[model samples]
Target: MVAPSPYQIVKKLKVSRVLVFRTAQRYRRLGTSDDMQRRGRPVTVTTPEAVKAVREKIRRNPARSMRKMAKEYKMSQGSIRTIVKDKLKMIPYHGSHLTTLFIDEKIFTVEANKNGQNDRIIATDYQSACEKGKILNKTSHPASVMVFAGITADGKTPLIFVDPGVKGVALGQFSLRKPIMDLPARRRPRSSRQRDSRVVSRQFSEFISAVDWPASSPDLNPMDYAVWIYLTEKVSSKNYPSIKALKTALIKKWDEIDDDHLRAVIDAYPKRLKAAIKAKGGRFENYS
Candidate 1:
């Protein structure tokens, strides 16, 4: 090897010094070199006990509002979400039923309930209009009644069909139940490979049948708003044929829904309940 020239040595030293100076400047900006803890607002001020307190409140009632929850438990929504999510391990919930949700159409209201009070008189869908009549069952001659379905996540909600006269969503809602009682048709999970085994397809897995659904919580029921929409479709236009026809139609439509789909809705109950309870009775938001 040939010896390097003095000029080459000087150039190499200059490049090394420039690199060190640039790195030092970057560290100074970040406050690491000066030992300065960069000042910023704290992300979390609530303690773990506070997290647990809010979590317990949510565990008891998921239909309550965040405003109420914050007031009652003294925490913010971010804090609440973190506690409920991280500490409680609750999943963000949505409805299980994969049905064609009708949103664009507004059902005419012959009756006014506390929820859907807007009588905007907008034009309605024709097919929805007919279905609305079946469910809404307006008397037309002296109309002042509404047919609302208060469904819950736990298998169609038994509370609804029982009284159909509760006020709060939890009390007012009914669980979706199948018409017949039989051995669960779901298959079992096994620790085996596909190549070696003949798989038995059960209609429902143990999970599918054994889910304990939440009742009347909107977090789980995306269709809860849709159900409200279903009611609006019924009484709108103030032109119904008869009450008997509407009731029969509503009951019929309820029966036609698939059992497995209903179970899926129930699966979303915990998340729905949490949202409703967190919001303290505010409208159930469609987080999806």
Candidate 2:
């Protein structure tokens, strides 16, 4: 195809620049907005000591979430997270770091630029396995063990901790060998991409499906998003008779969903697809 006219190219470039600026301004506006800051009451934890405490906690335990620290320290999590990322500089844990370590550093490289520099590899874990490739069975009970479990907007359900259970799909441990942390419905988390599993674990490959991956998206899974909305509504209003009752309720609701409700969700997938593309491959939080 022929290139656009120079005037048209300039116009397109201008629009792109304006769009970038607008996005930045929107984020800035959201940050400076009063949505989080209370309508009244003076701030208490603005002192340098409190700020230092937040950074130290973040540095010591990079995987410890902001909300958890806020609860334990009696501070706001958003404030803590913003301060940590802006000042201390730590990436809140990603799925790539969840394993005990990589299985082989000899050849495996992390997802990096098309140029392929060795700098992309995470220094310590070039090769690791999930405690010796134990989940090889297609019939495994948690056939889909949602890593994190907790109450959400509607009901108590197993949080979709990790999914598409493929390579790079290891569950993130909160501690050295601990399970992942679960959060309530009020918070949404940022997730990371998983790397492919090593070929030596070919035994588990029978269960992996390419369709499950869906074009580098967190937005594709219906059970991950739409179903959560239903679950939250179902559980929050009524008190569960017991923990077992909660489990039964979750299973039932999950099964009871019919085709039409699912189709409506399928219909929205394109919009999400567009948003992801427009965002230049950025995450679009289902909650947000």
Candidate 3:
């Protein structure tokens, strides 16, 4: 039988006519279809060592500029950029300035008012205390302290200080155990929202029993509406040279917060929940 024509092969094999013809010609001439080494300059800069070095630098500081990296690595800026973009698959991002209002505004309301009248829902969060002058002016390396605290309907808990640059397992080990253990079992409300980090901790589920709350309802949290705002205002009014000084001032101000004021804030939860429901999980106008 005669061999099929290239057109017939193209139709039968569902391949391009050019590819079929090329394959036939190559097989007749070279007796194999493997790719031959073509004449071109070999790659020099994108070596395995260079890739490892580039990855290490990026791991060390994600925000490091491509120009700075090129200067340090003695490679062309274009080469460094290619490594970052194509080889490393990283895109440079200017960090966003996040605010509570922005987050609360985005949260879609969930059905979370099963026991609307219960006063056991606690609220917890992290607040950064830095010199207000430096923050306002946007100048020099500003020292800050990450303060973790919570509030119940009755009153506030003692302030917890998380060390700078600590997260994940380190955060779990350094900060979570004490405050959770110290919480009076009587006041350990049936449910609470302590932000994503606290919720994700390995020990969190073990100590704090499983309780669900609407992810987007910070407006419902007394800590966000009353505690943090008040603390931030009080802390910002003074200046501190170091985090230690800032922490001392924070503890002082926290102690000064009257139980009456705290109770009032806690009592406002029902109204906030009602407002949240009225708005269908959007930002409540009454939140202050």
Candidate 4:
């Protein structure tokens, strides 16, 4: 018998010419029009119910681990991950920065802050690593002061000096002595850690969802990834003889920070989110 023309195939099969040829080619190669059996194990755990359960769990704790969920749900970690990524379309954000102010704390030392740029020095092989200005005291630690601050797209909160050896409970009360903004609060690591205390948690009860504001994610905060770096670079430009001097430098530079720079950092936040998604909730520093 004669083979049917493309027009006849399309007219009878009700498919486009492209699909008709594709099907014909598949059949010719595989000796069948039906789908070939795919290699590897078939999907078994990522069901609608599983997806719903996983969604509810993550809604309760966005930082909930897939391994923990797998144990709870009696499924493999891979299965739980698939439900999160493919079905629920969730990304494991390091921290959420969608707040009126991005708040964080940093400890500044009296000694020069040793970083990649500042640590490098021109020296011969015989030179000591800790010669003169680079010398670090072995017995005693450098005098350091912790500072807490909040940043907005337009301005920043005054640097609040945190007292030495303050506990979480005391720190929360001390830091939030005055309400900075009328809007809901979201904070970086310090506040996130403070929420672990029952007293501190109560203080943050009026704040945003804990699930959305889990700790240890500085990458998302402009303060952590951007502003702090700038401040550190400027402050570490010269070694301070005392914590008082470091504090003065910090306050002065903080006040002088250009509003335009703040706006630019805040504006880049959405792009950071996209890069985080592309990294599948993993480290996205290189991707960004």
Which candidate's TM-score is highest? 4
Per-residue CA lDDT of model 2 for 91-162, tens digit only, reads: 675553111111110110111112233213233343433333322222222212222332222223333333
Candidate 4, residues 46-92: lDDT per residue as tens digits? 88888888889888888888889999999988888788888988877
Instruction: Please identify which of the two predictions, 2 or 4, would achieve the higher lDDT against the true structure.
Output: 4
Computed on alpha carbons, the lDDT of every model, listed in order, comes to 0.45, 0.47, 0.63, 0.74
All models, RMSD in angstroms: 20.2, 26.2, 22.7, 19.5
Query: Candidate 4 — which pairs collide?
Result: none
Better of 1 and 3 by lDDT: 3
Number of clashing residue pairs in every model? 34, 12, 0, 0
Identify the superior model by TM-score, candidate 1 or candidate 4.
Answer: 4
Candidate 2 minimal-lDDT segment of 10 residues: 103-112
Question: Quick one: ranking by lDDT, best first?
Answer: 4, 3, 2, 1
Ranking by TM-score: 4, 3, 1, 2
Give the alpha carbon lDDT tens digit for every residue of 1-288 in model 3. 998888899999999988998888888888898655568987689777899999998899888889998999898999998898889898888784221111111110111112324423333422232221222332344555566666555445577776556653554444545554465765454444344555556645545433655566545566667777777667765456666677777789888987688667766667888887888887767744
Q: How well does model 4 score by local distance difference test?
A: 0.74
Clashes of 1: 34
